[model samples]
Target chain A: MGLQRGVCVIGAGMTRFHHKIHKDKSGRELFVEAALEAMESVDKGIERKDIQALFVGYFTPSLYEHQGHIGPLVTDWMGLTPITGWRTETACASSIAAFMTGVLAIASGWYDVVMVGGVEKMTALPTEGVTDALSVAADDDYEIPAGATFPGLYALLAQAYFKKYNMTWEDLQAIPIKNHHNGALNPKAQFQEEIMDIAKRIGQREGVTFKDPLDFLKSKYNRVIAWPLRLFDCCPISDGAAVAILAAEDVAKKFTDTPIRVAGIGFGTDTLALHDRISLTSFASAVFASRQAYKMAGIEPKDVDVVEVHDCFSIAEVIATEDLGLFERGEGLKAAVEGRTALDGDRPVNPSGGLKCKGHPVGATGAAMIHELWKQLRGEAGKRQIPDAEIGLAHNVGGTGASCGVVILRR
Target chain B: MVSGSAAQFLTKTFYDKLKEGKLIGCRCKKCNFVMIPPRLLCKECGSKDLELVEFKGTGTLETFTVIHVPPMRLKNVAPYVTGIVKLDEGPMIMGRIVGVDPNKPEELRMGQRMQMEVIEEDGKPVLAFKPVS
Candidate 1:
């Protein structure tokens, strides 16, 4: 069902997503830091007490921070206590769910202004611990017990998609290369170096020369994490936070004259386990959510000018693009390899560098995507800005596409 | 969601039969819809009338992956091949592909006939698959 009144995003902010950067900062600290930045970004400033309620999305505070009940903790940290707050968890898409909740809160005439965001502090644990933490999002009894790690699970999809479409792994190289390029321009991205630059730097440091990007990717340093997904193809563990401020459309002018309207919002979920899905080649959750958002917004995929997708892996970007109806089935791979998704391309995808470069802080990823869309829609993206960008879409997915959220924004 | 045997499906009996090298799944008597590892109710039609029927122990390899980095439980066998198979009885199930080089995943062809067998690992029976010659 559609909302009674529209919700518009007036301000958005995020901390630099990195692995070791936010070492001493706790999840709540990161949340407050991002929240303060978002508050300051509004065209016309608003006070903290003006925010009616808080909705925080944190995937696993127990695993990372050894803390639970993070909703109250975040509100307390922001000094907005007793204003009503709740936490959302959907593996990686946690923050998007929070954003959707905040939008509905405004649309229902329940609250005129709401603050929503997510935070993930994953560097507290070892790499193996993070992998295990992410894997539990799948069906515990079925997938996890059978030695199914996230990469291995996605590897199965990559294999099946490759076999069905007669594709090779070489086609995937384009995605990382492109993301790295856009990330190079993003000041806040975790990895801001181009793939070729990284290759050259690593070659010099290791005293091993490389001919090109592909050659460097094949080396032992970039060794395989899974069968087809190399280390370069996977997103790194990062700690960061992102927040967005939403206000009712009629009352939005008080906060910001340039409010980007949340034109459409949609959410969908499917069976957690991988085997239960009818088709592994595409994410049904993404398709269902995107279709609902497109229908509600009265716009097709082609109407979207710039987009950001949940590219947890290179293959995931392909699947998300096709599932969102941005590209045809089996055509996403070719689109990636042909640079059809480049920053300056026809349908620019992930101009914010996506999860591969902008960094995936689990809970904060969704709000970070919205932050990028807010920038690009306002003609604020300095180097990666799409010319004449009017509308943008953000697609965030939880573990293995089990949960999905698609939001369409218009400037 | 698959809480326990109290649901009448997704119970220990599914794995118990596998120890004897028997493949069984839930088959809907009314709709003739079959599912691997059994289920309390049919997902297609919500048919509660179901029976455990022995499968032919054969299927086609739908997809597979070689896990270089396994979970904490399977750390010993770090690099192993696990796959999804579309059974002859019309259900997709997860099984580790045995009798093949895990590193050379390309050798595992899709749509190739695979024989299902129950293999004991750490004193627990798990469903596995091998290329049928």
Candidate 2:
């Protein structure tokens, strides 16, 4: 069935994702910055009062920022209080969940124009504390209690992938290197400089010489956090915000003539514990969500012109590509090493640098992914633009692939 | 001195059995799905008919990861391999890989035959898997 009413993304915005102390600013402040930027992106801007609803996504705000009731807090800061505002939490895919809700609300004829935003201020906690907080999204009874952190969990996936595909640690480095290369061109990316640059600087500082990027990657400083997965392979603990303005297709043109239509949307959830999954190489949530989204869009994986898949860790991108049906099972790593996912490659994946380099702000990651696709589909992506891009897709996944949201956008 | 939280209860049971060289799983009555960590409910049918069944201590390596930087409790045993093994009784279990080098990939192939054995860690019988000889 078609969306009862059409929903189109008219504007998008994001705050540079970074690690911020609570003393600097709160998560609400970061959301406001992104929301304001989104408002400015609209060609024919409407008054903030005209916004009918707001969807906000945040993870561990109560623990990280010591803030609760974030829904009203963000609306109050945006001066949209008294308007309907709700908080959506699904770990890293929280914002995408909120975005999907906003889309459904418009399609259901409940709200004509809605402002969807996601924010996370998690860097306020120390590294150990943050890891503990994020672990709550996983199956606490099985995973966390077994001394499984996020990295450890993903490292398991990495190990499985390596075993199944006969890959090496050096192959994994290709992901971070590519993402960093793209991130260097992105002004909003957290790790803007390539890791090789960092490696060179460290070598110079220590009066030593690195054989190559892989050599530096293997060193103790960049030592493995999980076996076969190094510190560089994991996404950083980040703080940031992102927002998008969605409107019914009838009213979307009023805001902008070049609105990106929400062609399809799908979401799915799977077993919280990794042990319950039948296969570690593919996320069932992503596979199911992609199937639903593709069916609704009346397209296949081959139709997507550009893509933004969750690369929370390097191995995740490999898994996501296979789960999304972009490549054959157990072949995503080979694609990455072969330069098939590069911006200039035939299929450009994560031109936004992905979470690997773009920075994952948990709550904001999903919406931020959509924001990148919107820009790419509209030919607005400055340096990392995909050539001849028309149809774009974004896949946002939550803790350990428990939840996933996939959306297709077409210009 | 054992914490009696619900999360720890099953692991405690497993630990108690580990001391006796037994690996246990919960077999579901509704779907016959066996949970390796011994869950309270069946994942496939959502049934709570769980019977603790001891595995045959033999399985195949489904996948694995070599951890270079272990957590605080595992730091002393850094550079160890952890993997999911598909047991003969039809369930996947995650545990450390013993009796193998962590750095070599040629030794850890998918679907490689393996067998489980109990090892002492901190004076507790912890279960680990080794490549079949």
Candidate 3:
């Protein structure tokens, strides 16, 4: 909305998301790896000189890696020297913001070609340290003072949603099961095994067994992180990177044979603290952003044959689908149970296993969602690909929806 | 005290007041819109003519959650209950829900009358609520 020039993603790439796989690697290293892959992905070939700007998203490098000025740092690491660059931050949606910023840069005719990506080396921090770092996304004063943990915040949303819709905890488990199933197909996903496989493997190790995935999930082994939200319900702390190359629409084909058009992109915001929201059950920011994006794209939610949503927690996926108008408020809770969001389902959501399975490296998440959509549109997505997907959407929420960004891509 | 902007200082004043058994809100002189965790300027009308006003400290529980795994600073006090309370003064605020079984969340219901109180944590006053049964 900020710029008039049309833009499209020419290439996209990412590293395998994980908790410890990138232990020997830094955020910059992961970023370069994804960037190099993206460079190699352009069908017509691309060089470092072709990229005129750099937009990166990293949640907290100063805290995660004791590093700052990550924009030029990563630019230099990628061998794209002397180009103007800046880092974007909006909690987990940082990378989506970067991608939108890149769109603006290209659309403004300020730059012909630009690189947008997100990286977060979150595994370096201990659990609580990670929690503390992420909390900065929420209201620092009221939320932290009230002991509102990230999980606790979403848990509160889950409770409110359940109360409003009369849904049970069992109805929500379908999300992880479906996401894990999709994740099992993704080579780059953090958790590549189904809940059944994980249950068996971990059970064998702990000398405990279960009747099924649901039984295993119900067990204390998947103990509550927050009431009504168990361990499996929360996304893991991961270290990874995702990058997308964007070019003006006219020049897009020069780089890639099948450029995914940036159809509609919009950003929205709400009060930082969950308490400040008018309703706990929905994020008005997400709804506003999605509506703006739809109007820009000139396509309804029905046109989105596939989508990748910010599922930092399970309840989020439901809220997002509802907020984005993909499903009615109460219907989103049952979408998973009804198998409507499956990869083979009519409207596949998060075919890349979403943030829950693909891994949520905060800053990398938004870009990764776009990466999945790109693959789906190009028919590059192998197992999790939705059939004949023409348009797709990525919804990224910052904190408990304090900041939100939506991007719709069309093939 | 967490050090930051003057706006944050004004917010910290809200906590300082809580420690002294007071519930304060910043009321705009123009529109009379109140910001509970006080603000430097009125969000509604952008009026700088704002003053702290005392609230009845009584409200209804809007929603709640029992934190099973808290952050590092709160790890010692794991399994604390947090909730959003709609203040009778017309703003919602977040605080710990004390004097209730955090595990038995069923015991708490939405719209239940709640009263604000302060509990000491790390020598700082933390805001909390208790159901008025």
Please, what are the lDDT tens digits per residue for candidate 3 over residues A1-411? 434888999999999999988999999999999998888888899999999999999999999999999999998997888899999999888999999999999888899999999999998999889998998887878888889889989998998898899998899999999999999999999999999999999899999989999999999889998888999999999999999999999898788878899999999999998888888889998999999999999989887888899999999999999999988779997888999998887768888888889999999999998888888999999977788888989999999998899999999
Q: Which lDDT value does model 2 have at A36?
A: 96
Q: What are the runs in model 2 whose C-alpha is more than 4 Å off?
A: A20-23, B1-22, B38-41, B45-50, B57-61, B66-81, B96-133
List, residue by residue over A84-173, the lDDT tens digit for candidate 1.
899999889999999999998889889999999999999998888888888878877567656778888888888888878888888788
Winning model by DockQ: 3
Evaluated on the second chain alone, the candidates' TM-scores are 0.89, 0.83, 0.90
lDDT ranking of the models = 3, 1, 2
DockQ of 3: 0.78
Runs of candidate 1 with Cα error greater than 4 angstroms are B1-7
- DockQ score of the complex predicted as candidate 2: 0.37
What is the DockQ ranking, best to worst? 3, 1, 2
Docking class of 1: medium
Q: What is the TM-score of chain B in candidate 3?
A: 0.90
* TM-score for each model: 0.96, 0.89, 0.96
For residues B1-133, write the lDDT of model 2, one tens digit per residue: 1223335327678778777888876777678777776667676798866677778889898877776645555657767777778899887777677889877845777688999987776686766889997
Q: Score the docking of each candidate (DockQ).
A: 0.62, 0.37, 0.78
How many angstroms is residue A78 displaced in model 3 relative to the true structure, after the best TM-score fit? Answer: 1.4
